[model samples]
Target chain A: MTQEYQDGNALAGPLAELFAVDVTAATGRCVSCGDTRRVADLRVYGHALGWVARCPSCEHVMLRLVRAPDAAWIDLQGTLSLRVPLPPA
Target chain B: MGIVSPGFRRRRRDDDVQLPPGQYLTEDFPVLSAGPTPNIPLDRWEFVIASETGQEYRWTWDELQELPAEEPTVDIHCVTKWSKLGTSWRGVSLDLLMEDVETTADYALAHSYGGYTTNLPLEDLLDGKAWIVYEYEGSELAPQHGGPARLLVPHLYFWKSAKWVRGLQLQEFDELGFWESVGYHDYGDPWREQRYAGD
Candidate 1:
């Protein structure tokens, strides 16, 4: 397959259902490859199931969001660390 | 439940068309891929069924056209939760494709053109549960929709159907494919709601 993934910005609406903060701007490290980058910079793959964000360098899944009838499953098990940006007071 | 969406314009509209668990009917077919879609020219296109002994049964685009074709109207459920009901397709049945081959393998890992793969029990690909479909909705299947041909195992989740399919390797081991190796379920059954590894 070619490198035809959507930008992490495409993840804003879906991730919004789970987090108040805009997670797309959050920087995180991919556990598989140790590449750190903003969530908005990741390569996102959208399917009928939901959005799967992969590490841009390693192509490993860093996050996946699949929703069921009454539950939403946001799996970030592939992440090592996440640093969400906050506003200065 | 009524299949409701905000101005969905896909295709068929069947009111009260009962859907599988957690699925919403879509009128238009949505195209989603993990990477780029391969464009295989008709001359270079080929389909192979690799037996456990390394025998590759191949069919060229022209030969495939010679095979008896069947038009199947079936419902498809995507892992993303969209269900398309009564979709029409034309293809050769797996039963016919396997008639000449002797295979005792227990599992199949369908390989696609663009490095995509999906595993299934060999039995799941046989007995008329699957096909090598090249046409959808009475027209030549589009590359975006897995042409020149793709595996059609509609019973399992659509991912298990394997888009841009090129070959089916028969082996004794249950080797996981692209999605299966990820967090996606090994045997994706949409009705059972098996979408992830634990589910």
Candidate 2:
């Protein structure tokens, strides 16, 4: 299998965190039609150190950035963050 | 990535029913959801494959018909799950075309008139899995269907086999096409289910 992009350890943190099974999943709603869809369905393109998520339904792409990899959570005003559920300790 | 939904075929609640595979006309089926049609004639058509080094081969509607034709009955399983099985098509063979041009590139990009394009490696293009189609089910091809010509690669998800194909641009490196630029995988293989990138 071909390996994915690993040039910057920077993306690894966000990818792992975003894809973590337990994280509360987030959905980006279509601004025009009010259709709800998974944020991963949104087209993601990196801009500098940050990323933008574009809605496929309405083509309304949104941008956000988090400098620190591990923090409580990245602040997204209306969008919900899918958080991983912590295992029993 | 969203779950690559099970192919559009198996989901059909109607189990015993089947549609003979081949290009279907809009007049017969009226399935507008398939996509829009390109306004072009079946007779006045041509296909060109150009190498980056400026070498080119052009086949007009008449010139293409002059070549030997093959009739293939195959099942085309679209990633969308609408398998049109037992379809028949007649067109030029990849081997015959390769004989005309000396490709210095490792890959090729399928270029269509409506700015729709897709890429394939030289190995895949020559693998006998691909064909350039012009006639469907023995009838003159309709416009909604890839008329006059289209590329059919059965092994991969159907879209990699572009519709309304006009020519091919040989590339030394990989270049993403319409769906690939969006979220679709660069190389769409049905077995691997590489429908979307990062899946």
Residue range B11-93, candidate 1, lDDT tens digits = 54555677778889887888878666787889999999999999889999999999999998999998877888888999999
C-alpha DockQ of every model: 0.26, 0.03
- Whole-structure CA lDDT of model 1: 0.85
- Global lDDT scores for all candidate models: 0.85, 0.60
Give the winner by DockQ. Answer: 1
Error in Å for residue A15 of model 2: 23
Question: Using Cα atoms with residue i matched to residue i, what is each candidate's TM-score against the true structure?
Answer: 0.73, 0.58
When candidate 2 is compared with the true two-chain complex, its DockQ is: 0.03
Give lDDT: candidate 2, residue A72. 22
Model 2 CA lDDT for position B185: 66
- Each candidate's interface RMSD, rounded to one decimal? 3.5, 14.9
Highest-lDDT candidate: 1
Across the candidates, what are chain A's individual TM-scores? 0.89, 0.45
lDDT of 2 by residue, B17-45 (tens): 44323322222312211123456664656
What TM-score applies to chain A of candidate 2?
0.45
